[model samples]
Target: MSTVPPLLDGPQADVQVLQALRTTWSDPPGWLGSLRAIDHKTIARRFIVATFVFFLLGGILALAMRLQLARPGLRLVSPEFYNQLFTMHGTTMMFLFAVPVMQAVAMYLVPLMIGARSVAFPRMNAFAFWVFVMGGAFLYAGFALGSGPNTGWFSYVPLASSDYAPGKGVDIWAQMITFTELSALLVAIVLITTIFKMRAPGMTLGRMPLFVWATLVTQFMVLFAMPSVMLGSTALILDRLVGTHFYNPARGGDVLLWQHLFWFFGHPEVYLIFIPPLGFISTIISTFARRPVFGYRAMVLSLVATAFLAFGLWVHHMFATNLPEVGKAFFTAASLAIAVPSAVQIFCWIATLWTGRLVFRTPLYFVLAFFVILVAGGMTGLMLASVSLDLQVHDTYFVVAHLHYVLLGGAVFPLFGAIYYWFPKFTGRMLDETLGRWHFWLFFIGFNVAFFPMHLLGLHGMPRRVWSYSAGLGWDGMNMLATVGALAIAASVMVFLVNLAMALLSGRRAPGDPWGAGTLEWSAACPPPPHNFDTLPVIHGREPRWMQQALPSHVAGLAADAREVLVTSALAARPESRPLFPKPSVWPFLGALATTMLFIGSVYTPWAVVWGALPVTVALIGWFWPGRRETEQALALEQSP
Candidate 1:
């Protein structure tokens, strides 16, 4: 049966349709226009590139720390500087790189996969990106000024308070948190709305892609999880700036309050950095394995369950803080129980590979390595979930090893896989396979070599965040080995960069469906058009392209003379509105600038809070004001009387 019936009768009609779409959906031309762009693709590309730049910068910090720790008593950096390096490294990896990069991937891929023209809140998407960029810039500016926060990424209070921290560095860190969390929260809201409201016609709840489902759950996590940190940071800022004494235990404030609030956000922050990569794993596995995911309903259920359970595990990070016994037991049980969903996902992927025809591309190599590395990390996590065991190694290298295992293994491994898998789709060219394999192996081996001995160091009682250790304590040899491994990992990253340069410059061209994938995105052109679709596809089932059938219908009647797209009912994707989008504007960027000033100004003086509101209010008013076109139409109607 014909999947899509001809909407236009002939060539002339098709040309007219194309011309109308091009005219209506076109972004403004020139560099200035590009700056004011609201196109999801442009914003997403900026996000992805900015994310990697931060990653590279963070990696350099990691290498610096490794060099300092490579041999005990090697004073590459002083203890104070070491503290700043580690704090910024952790902060950049978690806030500046991981979560934003995952969101960037979704920003680019989600609309294409779901057959939507653009994200639901296009202006907000651009604003989120700008806010993130400015926030990172603000944080790094403190570093450049030699005033980086020295406490930790968690920035536990009393230590991070004005009395002891005694600098603008901690203030900068606190405001950075506020900026980033707000940005993340806004992006999450937009993504959740888009998933629920902007799916193509007939792409019902059950028919949505697994990656989309994973993204939905992750954004919900971000929505629920981000506010706690923002609140905590705001309170911390108030304490630092105005002497509110929220963390001032001597004045009746409880130190444990910061722990509770921070961890409440912190533990889920791990999954915030981890879950979307799980989505990448499922998508890549399904495509390369040449089969439907082994357990679609189960995978969706597991993702939802994982997100819910993630909230309950936050208290586990506070195991050594001397909580009530029952509370500890409850949190430990919750932490351990959370692993069942992860195990289910792991087993399902393994079963899929066992039953299907597995293609071992560079992407799959990383996924395969993820299975080994992440499972190993999960095992260590189970160990740490024990209150007794956690007390023995809570602040030691063991915890460090476990974290990298979960993050690098679970998140970054799949991230690279997704990058290779989707690179062709985005750039219309193939990455060099030989270089890709080299990148994967060197990174994999170097990652293990660098992190594995930390397990032994922890077992031997090596505490974390120490600038130097005594050479006689049986740590020097392993530390040296780790340094070598860190260097290897750095080399691997350099190779990957070279390969990306080669691909962009002169790699073989990619076809639309380079991987013979089974998703709506593959049905579009490689480096798809500005309008996303020449004609909007009507989805019939999951894996529409897999079935090799035309879309069951096309979303017609959406005006091609203006920026109009279908707005659907939340559950069934029944069209509800034909909304017109505003043309790209510079206001979001300008508003973000205003907001950055508010955050930065508040760091030095509390009065900035009162004064900062004026510019912010003005910018927002200008941002949402009706366009000249809309005002003209309203004026014409009024004058007709």
Candidate 2:
């Protein structure tokens, strides 16, 4: 059996082991690594591409809806088909795109920013990505097979029950929710563990970057919020397939219970999606503004405070459903109260930009736009928080406009900026400036043009989800204008695609620290190595790159020839232990395949669950039944801890 290698030490030894380090940490030669590699960078890249591909698919569905709605009396699609388009578009973007994309980006950047060799559970991270892909595939496959969900992404009950909705479609929708939410939960656990136990020595909670703090809070939100929806979906599947009464009102299950469970997750879901971008905005503002962000402690407290209050306000979505006055009052208070933390964060970013030496890159332009867009969205949100006003425009185009403004403006714009800022470090190429500016202007203008008119249409009594409308309703003009803007948004995406293509193929090669940022990620080589850093950094401040002169260059004595990371105390970040991480294996992929079968098979027949469990059990055995070598290494590591 193989034995643990001696741990390497000393600054000179760190230099000497660079080549050995790369070799030791490199993926196995050929398909063994190519197909089953557990390296965070490789897995993160794949996760990112996969999520964006889903984003593109979601965008196509939206464009089709826009086309059908472009002019009154357009029969480009039937009402039935329109239902499919609307439902799948929201599902693809929410479950498949927005949430996953943020996790994907974080999965790539988190480890490097925290100065860890890999995520806390690299194997679990791979498994999470696979499960996410399979879940998305399961969803789209049903759509292709004419069994796609048409009951809306929310899939409210009575309508979603087997009585009203008889088909494989709702069954597929219920199952897919369980699938994607499981993937989300696993990833959240991976990120939380990494942030808590794997930070570099001397990087205390106070010294952590705002991005890292944001990631931590978001994951915690996921852990708490996701299970509510998962439980709701599971109960839904049981109700549909087994005749349970979890959501059936006549037999004692309340229809409003579904709303409660769903919105509990739903409202927090918006913040979880929105919060990460707050971190992205802060990082970009600090980088382009050339200063540490203003009010570090306040920013951290604001993030935590926002998370706590998000749960209390979910009942506001149920205001028109005849909730008690006291309950409505409490929820309304909650919805407005959450805005305080958000405004504080906004002010901090503005102050950072106002006082510092500013650089106006594509990322900064996007950040600047974020302020205007989110503030507008927030005002509408306050309006919606009022029970009296919301009763007027409930389920109208105004709600649609408000949502996109919050999601697209609050999340997507910043994501684009993040891409521009981090692209060089990721791909070792600078995205062309002129093309980026063109892409931004088109996207910004297109977004406003497409969404702004919807607010007026809503006020004019344009209820959403209508396949077509009469031409004389005074809505045609705005509808046409919105369609034109949709095309512009499409064109902007095309420009971004072109820019990305040109940069990857033949753009200017970037140097390490091309932006001269203070974060630890820029301290590494451009595009970073498979092993990340050759030596583990000893952090002395929030921006390790800026404090490099005062710090000890490297932390020594971790094993160089094994997949290992320092286990630090959660609060103080003092070194506690270095444990050997598992190597690349195909079992994660195999395990995902097994789980997918169980989920899909359960949709058609109940016995499939029992049959499916067999292979799933086998896959689990192959995955966690460690060999003699791993057992020996674990024993050795534990001996001295």
Q: Tell me the tens digit of each residue's lDDT in model 2 across 1-641.
A: 11123344576554657766677677677976665778888887888898899989999999999999988899998898899899999999999889988888898898889888889888888888888899999999999999988989999998999988888898998889988899999999999999999988888999888989999999999999999999998899889998899988789999998999999999999988899999999999998889999999999999999999998989988888978899999889989999999999999988998899999899999989999899999999999999999999999999999999999999999999999999987898999999999999999999999999999999999999889999889999999999999999999999999999999999999988877799988877888887788778888888877763654678876666567778999999999978788888888989999999999999988888999999999988998889898787678656743
> Candidate 2 regions off by >4 Å?
1-16, 29-32, 633-641
After superposition, candidate 1 runs with Cα above 4 Å error: 1-9, 548-551, 630-641
What lDDT score belongs to each candidate, Candidate 1 first?
Answer: 0.89, 0.89
Which consecutive 10 residues in model 2 have the weakest lDDT in total?
Answer: 1-10
List TM-score per model, in order.
0.96, 0.97
- Candidate 2 residue 463 Cα shift, in angstroms, is 0.4
lDDT of 1 at 621: 97
Q: Give the TM-score of candidate 1.
A: 0.96
Query: Candidate 1, 219: how far from true, in Å?
Result: 0.5
In candidate 1, what are the lDDT values of residues 1-641, reduced to their tens digit?
11112256688777877777777667789987876898888888899999999999999999999999998789889999999999999999999999999999999999999999999889988999999999999999999999999999889878998889998999999899988888898889888999999999888999988999999999999988888989888889888878788888788888899988898889998898889998999999999999989989999999999999999998889888868999999999999999999999989999999998988899999999999999899999999999999999989999999999999998999999999999988889999999999999999999999999999989999999899987799999999998898999999999999999999999999998989888899877888878899878888889888775553568765556567778888899998876667778888988999999888999988888889999999989998999888665444433432
Error of 2 at 482 (Å): 0.8
lDDT of model 1 at position 370:
96
